[model samples]
Target: MFLAILASNIRLVSHWSESRGVYDDICYLRQAHLFQRFGWHGLDTSLAHETDGYLAGKLRSIDFPNWNEPTRAPCHTEIADGSKWVMTPPPGTGFVLALFPEGFQVIPLYALANVMIGGFALYGLWRAREAGSLTLAALFGALSITFMINPAKASYSMAPTMVVCALAGLVTARLFVDEGRRRLMMIAAVGILLGLSASFRIANVILSAGYFLFFGLSFLIWRTRETFVAGLTLGLAFLVGLLPVFAANLVNSGHPLVSAYGGQDTAAPHLDPAVLRAYLRDTQFPLMVIACAWTALLWRFANHAGVRQLTLLVGANLALNLAFFATHPVFTPYYIIPILMLSLWTLLFAAVFTRGPVQGFDRAPPGRPRPPEMLSRV
Candidate 1:
């Protein structure tokens, strides 16, 4: 199932034109080129050149076969030098894209990378599932890949990041079940992956923050030495993964913590309150339905750690989306996608949770041990 989904994504990305209709695809591709020529220290002047039509006019037809002068839209920010303007969006996606050679078709490479991350996500889900329920693991693996290859986001940067976010979220939930050295290792893995996800899209930092709180509270409630060490290790690994982005910000924006996005005026009209309200209205109907069903199931299986953490993950992302819309009214369908993915995963967990324990499955299976340091009480 994973292979099939990955193949589909590869086919989809392979066929995409270099200059597609998606707003940020070209920007990332251009940024990738800039990164190839100049690493994180120097700014990419091509953005400014594109803005002024000089780059578009001079960019070779052979190089940019699909370049549309009338539809050409180049994004630039005023935070850096005019000649060295960088796109306001985060450079994480571009950095991955930088691995590809100039003028080479990148969507396939991008799709391939997403599949690798999706594999990690599927493995994490499988590892975390209760014993004797191979069916559930298979179901989740299929569902995750289906979401990954969804045709709606064929050319969007959000596609890969969504896969990464799903993996990180699943790894985080797994930390609750595993124990001792294994859980600590998972903590390090989660931090590193979450950091990578944040690079693709900075909004993922909210998800990372959500995980930190979730782990921290678990430690506080348990007050165990293992949990304390686990939390600190996770935090440190996450910071290490984020080092590149921090360094880039320091060099490009002269502030280590401040991001390139800070330079953009998000309060612009397209992203104002009215559009946010409309998006909010559109999403409420579906959410209301999910909430009703989700609450009933939770009441029945409130003891299950999976159920609780899934709720937190989905709720955190939903709140993040809502906060963004409330503050900046401009909306894009992609922004709601991570919420949708988490919601679907939550619904899946609710199904398994409400079913009660599968018959004949041991609480601690032979291959998977319930270590002494496991959060048995929580």
Candidate 2:
């Protein structure tokens, strides 16, 4: 099933590439080729690093066609500017591209990698399932793959990061709810993965903050020293994982938090308060409403522990989106990575919950009191 999905995603990406020739695959392909050739040393030769003169000189040296005009600035600069150039290859997309061999287009590779990552997340979910509902676990895993495998828009760009975050969330949920002995390590690993996701896309810091708050509150309520230790371990792990992004930011921009692209407010200068208000009134509000309704319904029917975690995930995404909409001048679909992750969790919860009530599925092996319908329902 995993391999099939990977193949499908590859085909879809290839079709999309052929249909939409204007996409930035060339830039990503070039970046990957450069990385394959020079490793870290190739950074100086990338369009991002070189001046127009330097770029032109390199192009001339390579005997590449110039089309008789000045070359355009790198896509990263266009995304930062938010002028006529709105869409660009997302940073995570670039990272995936960097992994492929020279002369290979990165889009299909990205899609394929995302499929594999989603498969890993499915494996994690299957492993964490309750013993009584293995069938439901498989069903939910299938659903998760189907829902998460879409490559349209920024989904492909964000998929790798989302997969890591989803895996971390799944592992953290299991460790927290099941009271596993390795809970501390699991939580720490989650933090590290979340930090790595944020390193790929800094907007994920909002989701990480939400996870920390939820975990901290849980620890306080549980009043266990182990919980405290887990939280601390997670924090330390996150710090370690974030070092690369911080170093990059500090080197590129004068601030650790600032991105190489540019500041948010500086990107869209024409974004008046009224225009922002209208945008929120139209696009964001409807998305929030639908997301909230679906999340609430899913939580209402899910297992108690799963419900709590899903609620935290949904609430955090919504809160972060609202906060970003209010403060940030520019918002992209990739910025809603937390929402996408939470939506998957909600769908999985719903699937598991709905599956529990079916008679044949619930029938026990002759002993255990019908297994309590849905495993500790809230």
Candidate 3:
């Protein structure tokens, strides 16, 4: 199933690359190429020359270099033909590109990384199931991937980061759910995964914050805060987990919180509050329906501890995604990461709901007939 999904994604990306005349791909490809040639710090000179050279080459190749004089901006130097001058690739993406050896095509490398990340997410789900049950685990994993693997959205520029975030979320969830004596280690591990997710996309810092709050609250509610030891332990874990993202942002953007992709004003015009609200209302209606459907499906098995955990995770992720839509000017497909995460948990809960009754039947008295199968034979 994983291989089939990956093959489909590859085919989709190939079709999009050839058929779509969009410039974002070229811009990202160029950034990847430049990163491969000159490390991150070396982007300045090469970016300028490459931008000019690409434009000049495009003009010569297409026989219309001077055709759109006003449309061409000077700052658009780092991108490929048809790309906007001011647009820049995300630093994390640039770093990924830099990891590739010279002469390797950047697009394929980036796509491959996205594919592998998806695989990692599946593996994490399987691991979660190993700690519990396969049906439940597979359900969650498939739903998450389904949300992400939609060709229309998944083939976009930010897909890699989205894949990374999903995998990180899965790993974090697995760490928390799996029973273990190494409480401190598990907390630290969750933090590290959250940090990695934030590094991929700065907005994921909000998800990390959510995780911290959820964890602290869960601990308090469970009455596990007997000692200052656990509180101090969680604090250190949070700090350790955030260090990677904070350090990367500080070193790359000179701001601990800011990402390479600037705010709404820098990227595009901000929508007015009224306009944004209307747009949100329109967009969120369908998402809310999906969320409710998922919840209803999961609610059937809410008696299980795992189902309950997944429910909370999905609820928190939905809240975060909606909160983001309320404040942010620009909305992109990548912002659906939280939604995708929630979808995974929904899948898991559905799986558990479906399987729970079956298990209960299996444990019924030997003389009693099995309950009518709710699901059709496999």
Candidate 4:
């Protein structure tokens, strides 16, 4: 099942078009071009920097009416004072695109992301060779890969975000079961990976909410030096991992904390029943339902403290993320996908790597000493 999913992903990726005429795609590719042409200085994504015809040609290929006008670039937003226009997204996706030559980026990206997830799936399968565990792993690995082509393909950022979520899920499981030094290291690793994910999609920063909340509450409750250190380590490493976005913000928005997105993109959050209904009507809604059910099940009956804590973390994360997206004024097919995927992946890995799920979540007979750590929220 896992091998077939990989082959299917390869077949799908092989046919993707880099210039699929998506506005976001053009902006991301332009960002990549800037980085490739100017190196780190590409942090300045101002439309004024388009001295060459690279962006113009791309726009023309898509038949954008204002292809020749710099200020009219599709995804570029004007600063509040109207001094200049800059790309809307954080620069990480662009940086990844820049790693590959232009006109050959998107496919390679999806391909690589698929392979990375495939590797994790294979490892999970290996770790759970027993009967019931094998079935769960195989089903999960299949869902995970096929997922890449549909919703994951909705945005270039999703590829890397998916990759980061997959890794964070595994590391999250390890953080609970492992002892001593290894536990600390997993905490830091998860923090770094989650932080770096924000560079791809600014909203991903919210992904850390459940984690910090878990750590904060843990420290407040236990008041242990261990929890303190654990929280502090993750917090500091997360900040370190956010350096790229900080740099991009400082360069593009004229301030490290300001956003480059237009008002609609960064508008204040509010209750939006319409948005909630939109989610309810979309395919992502089913996944959201499934994730909530899984999290609730684990939280209700898990025996292991680490597993229970992990479940609480996921439950918290799902609630927070769902609330945020639900109340926001807009909806998209892929908007809820990251959180859904993250929650599901974390659950799947916990089932695979931990010794403490209630009954139905896992029955992988005693696998040697399970890796260890636990606190709950995204």
Q: Please tell me which predicted candidate would have the highest lDDT against the true structure.
A: 4
Q: Where does candidate 2 have its weakest 10-residue lDDT segment?
A: 81-90
Model 3's TM-score against the true structure: 0.64
When 2 and 4 are scored with lDDT, the better candidate is 4
**Candidate 3 regions with alpha-carbon error over 4 angstroms:** 1-5, 15-27, 40-89, 101-157, 218-288, 292-300, 306-310, 342-378
User: Please, what are the lDDT tens digits per residue for candidate 4 over residues 215-282?
Assistant: 99999999999999999999999998899988988888888878887433556889887887788899
Off by over 4 Å in 4: 262-267, 355-378
After superposition, which runs of candidate 2 have C-alpha atoms over 4 Å from their true positions? Answer: 1-7, 16-34, 41-72, 75-92, 117-156, 218-224, 254-258, 262-291, 297-310, 331-334, 346-378
| Residue lDDT tens for model 3, 1-378 | 665666666675554432133444444444555556656543432334454464344333344446244244222432222222333334444456556653344446545754765575466455442335564455545544444445325334455555655555544445434546765665666556555555445565566555555566776777665324444665676567666555544544556665435522343334457745564565445556666566665656555565566556556766766666556666554455455453554344334333433332335567875556622321
Give the whole-model CA lDDT for all candidates, comma-separated: 0.60, 0.54, 0.50, 0.84
Kindly give the stretch of ten consecutive residues in candidate 3 with the minimal lDDT sum.
73-82
Error of 2 at 354 (Å): 12
| lDDT tens digits by residue: candidate 2, 234-297 | 8898887777566555544445665655632354334358646655655334545666765676
Position 321, candidate 1: lDDT: 50
Q: What's the TM-score of each model vs. the native?
A: 0.70, 0.66, 0.64, 0.90
Q: Model 1, 227-311: lDDT tens per residue? A: 6987899899999888767776775567779776776666552446566566667644364356445645554566766556656
Clashing pairs in 1: 271-329, 271-330, 272-329
Q: What is the lDDT of residue 254 in candidate 1?
A: 71
